[model samples]
Target: MRVRMTGLAGVIAIAALLVGAAPASAAPGDASAYGARLDVTLLGNPAVHAEPFAAANANGPTQNTFVGVDLPGILKTGVINASASRDDKSGGVYSRASTADVRVDLLSKVTGKISAELVEAECAATQKGLVGKSKLAGVNLGKLGQVNADPAPNTVLNVELAGIKIAEVIFNEQYKNNDGSLTVNAIHVKLLQGKLGSLGTGDVILSSATCGPAGLPIPMASGAGLWIGLGLLGVVAAPVAFVALRRRAALNAA
Candidate 1:
């Protein structure tokens, strides 16, 4: 039995499977949501809200959640695993997980929706948490424009900042789950045409910060990379600048 959580056209279907199916009339707090069983290789308890729960109480859900993102600098990529209960009476966990989705409006030229799809699923029998892998899927953003952006690939909120095309800005990729943890992937941008410059479509891990929270999931300064990179750049530039100045001054005096 599979419960189907259908999204707008092209949206990934979140279906209840193998365990059994339920009607769509089930309520969130209904008792049936706690019982339907799934075909688990390593059966752990389906996700239940433990004590010390948040006011939202949204760890795993039966209803779909909406997420908004700031793109690029905020988050590049990540994945999310979720189970929804289909049994209105049995109201149990949806056997498989569904990837989150997003809609892109090409301002003027293009507009469509893109959804996230699970690439893999491995829920630990003892831990009860399923780890699912995903990629940017259902990406059909219509026709390509003069810029060469796939539109289907991920793009950022704004195309031009500081007169930079920021072709590889993927905003929807930046996510926030019901809770406020953040995740950032990578960024790529190259200049192209027009007063604003042409752009290309970009991609990212949707479940990351894009599906999660407003606050950052991890701290930025946690790594030594930033400090080292800055130090190296300064060290390499200082000597060259000093030597060039000295040579120029000596030649002028001569």
Candidate 2:
């Protein structure tokens, strides 16, 4: 009986060591975001092409801000802000972007003006938290049509010049990247026509965000807990075995 109890204790101790040596859980996903990205041309001349402020894979909170920019009669902006952050607690990521005071004069025919406010975009691990918000104050799109404040993903607003389609305004643009990441753009302007009567063609983006895939769930008893429990069992068995051996020795002596 004592030998059997000793063997059981050994087995329990070995199992505890194995459980403690198991590999750890996978790490959380990465995150990336930008305030504004512009790739445009005026009569084949590069106007504004750059991503002014951006962040990626930061362990903590990160942010950036820009005063204003201009393309002289083509496009103009005021006060751009962007931010990105990660939550180690929930293994989730988040990002946001916003712009203010925007004006776009395309060939002086199809003009757009937004007063003191522009757009914002947010991204997170969950679908409910991923959204695009438009704060287009005093918006006036001359001959282009109305702007949707809360536009769905890939919502397109056609641009026409003299009853002919010339360009398009895409809102809440979202893409599921090949690597399972999600990208959200608050606003995207694409000039389809090569030249809208000498204006030229290009693309413009505002308030962009992206986040990597969700992390796998972690299980309980996958770490030290399992080892500790088995260790306690081994301790109890050792004392029980010692007691059994002492009693057997006394009986043999008698």
Candidate 3:
């Protein structure tokens, strides 16, 4: 009985190893499957896409014990886990639904200009691939009005840095959520290239990717390769089976 039980346990272990050997559909507690994905390509004299993400979520540091919550401090709030990404082949922009409640507070005091200049400076120095004249511009998404916290104050703001233009981009959304997590979705950002005079006039690309969940690190493709290898084994085995079957038939005919 003991020996039989040991053999059964060995079989189960082997099966578990096989299933776990590749990136299977994420199990429960694992992030839900990556939802929909979007991609875009454009052409013209000014070739580029400024696609915006639909809806999404992001994070940050401990709220100040007493300062009135404002945009600059909120900007400092870091996203612990972001479902943000960008890719030429896979997607242009993406957003996760805000999980917490939201009530955006529009503040007239905050000017997007400071953030715009700051971003442009950073890009000119580090983003070699992004060459251009760019600056921030606001799209009149009129009547966004004052944002407020829902249920009274927790909401999530998901922002992906990947999809932003290198030269300059402006954020005008003023927000607050019931749970303290506020989310901002697709916003119009201007693009530019070459010289300062030429900024916000032509070609640029924008994009984002859905990050899985908070706390978990972004998943690498190593597991994807493992699954691909398993699939290739299936293809190779099919040919070997065909050859073996042909041999058996030939002998029987003989």
Candidate 4:
């Protein structure tokens, strides 16, 4: 008996194999497997709260209880490992061990949701208590889009502040968890002096702040490169395999 397969069938088989080998997209919270953090600066005196532990603690996770915040103008080592450019005179390089997704929630009647990539987060005790702050200077608002207000998701808040820096942004002790990582509860955004779209700005205030759940771990660069190489090889080999198989079948039949 001769074994035979058509060109189309061979192509499909190869495609199936590649798809099976590919990894699933990292979901929210997958990135925070090690830990997570959130930093926010608001323009209001309103008090807010968040329950970041609620999701992990609903069933009680085995993760440790360590938390911190990132403040502006502070030189933290090895926190943000992206293509961030810093003009520090000391000349130090920062490399991240891994990246994670982090969410911040503004707990109040009217809420505001904010989140950022947890590329670098350091939690430690201070005279005031635990303070963790990360650098968020180069973040592109276009990627983040207009900040949305809760309940009325359609209402996207607009800010026209140029060279905007998430300054004076520090995570205070209000955020705490006994069995999990710290989640940002509330933030106070002081206008300092800026404009809010049409609302001519002298003083802008934030009612509450909130964060979405953490996202999954980003794909490893090495792994992705390997998969690409394999996929290309499969594409080139599929046609050759089909032709060879067809010739073999014809020879056997003859």
Candidate 5:
């Protein structure tokens, strides 16, 4: 009886290992629409896209931040704002978005400027992307409004981020599993809007991505080679599974 019990224990242990070792989904699956909760920073040039908007413009620093909160990727909400300086070398232009709540899809991607069309789709999609609540700050005019310029000698311009241009994005792709843990994947963005700006008005490319959720780091991937790199992660996780099973069984017996 003792020998039989030992054999049965081994079988159970192996079974547990297999179950625990079941592979991560091939894609995000139903949860693909969401991503791990994280704060994000986007940086790019704004002057390049300011062609028809401003003749000879230069963009200082283009940045946008996505605030993280406690929720699933699809139902998640966040405060997002961006700022940039566009100057025709004579006048100054600045941009701002008053703090507002927007529905977010952490795993999704935005290509060109965040146009009315894009905003509508995300907010309207079944797994909505961005659900903007209300306008935060009143739109600040850069050239039309006579505002104080920064250290630079130019017209003060403030444009609300009603539409934004994006060349690339580095965002977390989160997948919430039945186990409750999130599987994160970083995507190094690549797109066509690199040469565009907000409302096709700014002179730079706008980029956005997620930053946190404590741990679980996944690298950004842009091409075929990215897959090859990700494949190795599964191999690395195998041994860790065995150790986890042993610890669980020991605790149960005790």
Candidate 6:
């Protein structure tokens, strides 16, 4: 009886070990989004500077608006609206950023003005794959030709003033982070020249979003069902082994 009980105990222990050895799904990732970031200098002096607006993450959404902005005749905008939001789904994460009614007076004398009715950026990560996209609507660059509504990744448009390239307007900028995350910027403006005649160099970004890598797929039978099935098998097998041992001992005694 003692030997049979020991053997049954071993079988149950093995069953428990099998259940514990099952693979576990990876942890879910995070997401973030923001709108309208400006870091520019005017006349060799740090004049116009503002952090990203309406930044949001898994915690909650954010929104803001400005009636008008005048950067001492260097930059100007009218009725700017920005918003950002993030969502965590079952097996993935999603983030979005949007802006509307944005107008920038880029060296009015040299380059007329740039305006966009709407700009948006989106990012999502799931078991299937990572997806990112940017949209520009009703955009007009005074001298620079028409803006591409659906530009490819990291598309750059040279900003030429008086036949001399001064800046670059990058659209749909995408970056693959080291930690398996992705960042997407709807529009990014980088000043190539050190000085725009008298205005200093700087960069501006609008409608940006980022999301971590996709979560691993969950196993079909990895949860409670797996443990229950293993437990039942052990219970039945243990009793059967005990009964068989008892019968054998009785026959040997007889």
For model 4 the local lDDT of residue 5 reads 50
Per residue, candidate 6 scores C-alpha lDDT tens digits across 55-174 of: 776545545555555555544445444443333234577777777776766545555778788888888887677789999999987876676898788988777766677787889999
Regions of model 3 farther than 4 Å from truth: 20-210, 213-254
In terms of TM-score, which candidate is strongest? 6
Residue runs of model 5 more than 4 Å from their true location after superposition: 23-157, 160-254
TM-score between candidate 4 and the true structure: 0.23
lDDT, candidate 5, 1-254, per-residue tens: 44345556655665554444333211121111121223232343222211111111113234444553333322233343433333322122223322233333322333212211011000010121211111212222222232221111111222323354333332222333454323322222233333444222112211111111121122223243346444544554555556556666776798
Task: Report the Cα lDDT for candidate 3.
Answer: 0.26
Measured on C-alpha atoms, candidate 1 has an lDDT of 0.27
Q: Compared with the true structure, what per-residue lDDT tens digits does model 4 show for residues 1-254?
A: 22335555666776665555444432222112223232323444332222222122211242233333233221111221211111122111111112233333322112233444433332323123333333332222333253221112112232233444322222221244543333332222222334332211122111111122222233312355456647676776767687878788788798
Highest-scoring model, lDDT: 6
Once fitted onto the true fold, the runs of candidate 6 whose alpha carbons sit more than 4 angstroms away are 1-26, 61-89, 193-198, 217-254
Q: Assess candidate 2 and give its lDDT.
A: 0.65
lDDT score of residue 87 within candidate 5: 30
* 239: Cα error in model 1, Å: 65
Better of 1 and 3 by lDDT: 1
Off by over 4 Å in 1: 1-102, 106-132, 141-163, 171-254
Give the candidates in order of lDDT, highest first.
6, 2, 4, 5, 1, 3
**Alpha carbon lDDT of residue 52, candidate 4?**
28
Q: How do the candidates rank by TM-score, highest first?
A: 6, 2, 4, 1, 3, 5
lDDT of 2 by residue, 1-254 (tens): 65566667766765665455433433555666666667777665756676555443345447777777676766677777777776655556677777777676543466445332677777777423443334345566665567667676888888766666777877788888898878888777788755444356677777787775654333224455455555766775677667668767777898
lDDT of each: 0.27, 0.65, 0.26, 0.31, 0.28, 0.70
All candidates' TM-scores? Answer: 0.22, 0.67, 0.22, 0.23, 0.19, 0.68
Q: Give the Å error, residue 15, model 3.
A: 1.5
- Per-residue lDDT tens digits for candidate 1, residues 109-153, read 322232222221111111132222223344433332212222223
Candidate 6 or 3, higher lDDT: 6
